[model samples]
Target: MISACHQCGEPIPPRSDDIQLCRHCQQSPPAFDRTHAAFAYTFPINQLIPAIKYNRRPEALGWLSLVFAQMLEDRIDSPPELLLPVPLHPWRALKRGFNQAGLIAGELGRHLRLPVHQGLIRKRRATASQAGLDRSTRSANLFGSFRLTGTIPAHVALIDDVMTTGSTAQELARLLKGAGAQRVEVWVLARTPTKG
Candidate 1:
């Protein structure tokens, strides 16, 4: 399969096992500490993601988690104390019968032998999807959105399906920090390249 670089949109060979970003990412990096993704959010990924989300294809999760775990194993030093999934609003979760991020995070926890903690909750309900929203609007929509219940582990990793503008991760990290989490690492299945 021909996969393109998630950052620069350059053609990536089928054997490009060790690459996630193009040269551009090395030049200007994201705010998160470390990011490793299984596949670029295009082609097969684009097809698979929506299928899993809309069609309720839970079977795809095993392969997704395996790919994610392999990518993560090569990047991080060790497993974090806890894995925190980016929470969906209760209504959305109820409607969908599952949170996609939560399912992926649970699989990651099982694969990595780490604990999955659903300590974070979405305090604010968002009617608009984050997609197509500007960074400022995204920030506003997610502002004061996440709240942590009970004790948070000293070291925690936030898990999500994709990292786009990163406002969601940033806001969640801020909440985690406020809740006494000493460090936050983002574990995403894909990171959308910034558009030029």
Candidate 2:
């Protein structure tokens, strides 16, 4: 199995020694303290994620969440105090009839015996999908997009289905820390390989 970056959870090339930091994370760290992802955003698994997100396949979602929960249990020695699904804009949640992240978080929370807090952070406005956008554009699009609510916990894990450039996770983690969270970790089902 491939090793992952200790900070961002992106896959690292197989190596002889244990190097925990990826080059990008070493140069400039992310807002979150750490990340844990179950799989790379590739192959048939990639197809399954969209099917759960866009195609409204509950069975697929359940199975994927179970797999992710097992991965989390295997990797994390101590679970965070809470689980927070990356919030969706109200309009988007209404249109989709659900937030994919929330659905996954719900299952993970059950499996981990952690509380899933849905209202802790919310998207203030809808932004264009991060797909196909450059890293700078993705950051700009999410600027001031999330608002923190409720009491911020000392330790929390932000849940999402996929982490691509990690712009979204970065923005949310910054906000969480600003709102008094001592440590924020990201838990995602899959992570895309970093661009060269």
Best by lDDT: 2
TM per candidate: 0.81, 0.95
> lDDT of candidate 1 vs native?
0.73
lDDT of 1 by residue, 36-80 (tens): 556667677877887888898877888888888977777678668
**Model 1: residues with Cα > 4 Å off, grouped in runs:** 1-32
Worst 10 residues of 1 by lDDT: 1-10
lDDT of each: 0.73, 0.88
Worst 10 residues of 2 by lDDT: 52-61
* lDDT over C-alpha atoms for residue 43 of model 2: 86
State the displacement of the C-alpha of residue 114, model 1, in Å, after optimal TM-score superposition. 0.3
For candidate 1, what is the TM-score? 0.81
